[model samples]
Target: MTASTVLYEPSKDGITTITINRPAVRNAVNHATSLKLAEAFQKFENDASQKVCIFTGAGTNFCAGYDLHEVAGNSTGEVAVGPVDKVNGAFGPMGPSRMQLSKPIIAAISGHAVAGGLELSLLADMRVVDTTAVFGVFCRRFGVPLIDGGTVRLPKVVGQGRALDMILTGRPVDAQEALAFGLANRVVPKGQAVEAARALARDLLGFPQKCMQADLVSAHYSAYDSPSLEDALRFEFARGALVVAEESVQGAKKFDKGAGRGGKFEKGKL
Candidate 1:
């Protein structure tokens, strides 16, 4: 694959879909592809008009993992992944895995999302999978360690027992099982993962932008950054307070005018 190994598509309706385009290798990410993936995500974050991002891969599989062929070629003890430091600037082997995006991202998983691919899916706020999708720590059998956010995020996502099971066994968890484990937010038909993810993104795009982003940031802070419950609450309050005047007042006025009543919902209503 060329530089197009990563495809970045931004729609006018505030949805950016980033695709891993190396289908020939089941979208296995190599060094160049990893850099492109990181760049695409940064672009999406920088574009204020893009409210939601749908991350998927080309053809069938979502991703196999970091391209082991590339790793095989590395005779030196050099890191195939980009620079890593103790700060927030760290980059994972799967690229954007380290990013704590302010906006929402949905992963559209169709086929094998194992090893680093599983880690990549964890980067999304939600995963929309199809019947063919599979999740696992496949790299465990190859003696490859997960240097991405996999170890940190998997436990938070699926609990300690389940995370340990996947980490220890490297077994394939099908779409249905993943849904039962709360790993997959939605399961669609065999080929509709991306479409389902797009619909989900549309729903998110309809919300009050500032208020939604503030809540998103606060949730991440509470989940990963806050040292204690008190700190989390204080951070949440502080972040939310900044959005009240900007979005909350107008949203309340709209609500008073009979919007979002009777449990009704429509795209772009807000």
Candidate 2:
């Protein structure tokens, strides 16, 4: 805990792994740690060489949520929240929770991801959770609100009823239940979440970058920004069309060369 509470490690293959290192407190996020986490994610966003990000917590847990100790000792009269500028992006008290990252992020969940931690995981495009992973709105029990994207994202990830069940009841959802609820994209063996997320990131890296990013952006826009079905389709088509000439043409040529024939994938070929 003496060292940085957040750690950032970048691999040569365009994978940046951001870790919450406060395992002593179940990797809880405090004001300082939240700022550090936001900075790390902003660094990843600014680095064009970093294609994907894997977010996890060190030791046994993903994150227990925001440090209640810090919240209880807030005598400075200043709001314990990160800066917010919705036009560009914003950071929540949990840090990076409000960021609209261009690159894909995979949440590697192992232990408890409750309250704010659950909100943090919702920021990721995908979650690779281990058997021990748990998701909940534990903050409900403490009368804490989900100021992060939890309230918005949770309903989108799972249905409104399911999200409400967890939100109102403050019950823990195990990995299996989370997967069934669409909260977890993949469930792996205990202790293998990070590796699985890294492997998934490698698979994503093998694809045409522009096309993948365009698709990702389009999907996000449709999910959260589009006004209607027509607007969503228009945005998707516009963005996807931009990448067609840039990546799809080459991908088509690769396909013609049988690189991905019969559903057989050749890494990095297309």
Q: Which candidate is the best by lDDT?
A: 1
Question: What is the Cα-based TM-score of model 1?
Answer: 0.95
lDDT of candidate 2 at residue 217, scale 0 to 100: 93
In candidate 1, what residue range of length 10 has the lowest lDDT sum? 77-86
lDDT for model 2, please: 0.90
Which stretches of candidate 1 lie above 4 Å from their native place?
1-3, 77-79, 85-89, 268-270
Residue by residue across 125-181, what tens digits does model 2's lDDT show? 999999999999998888888988898999988989999999999999999999999
Can you list the residue pairs that collide in candidate 1?
none
RMSD versus native structure for model 2 = 2.1
TM-scores for the candidates: 0.95, 0.94
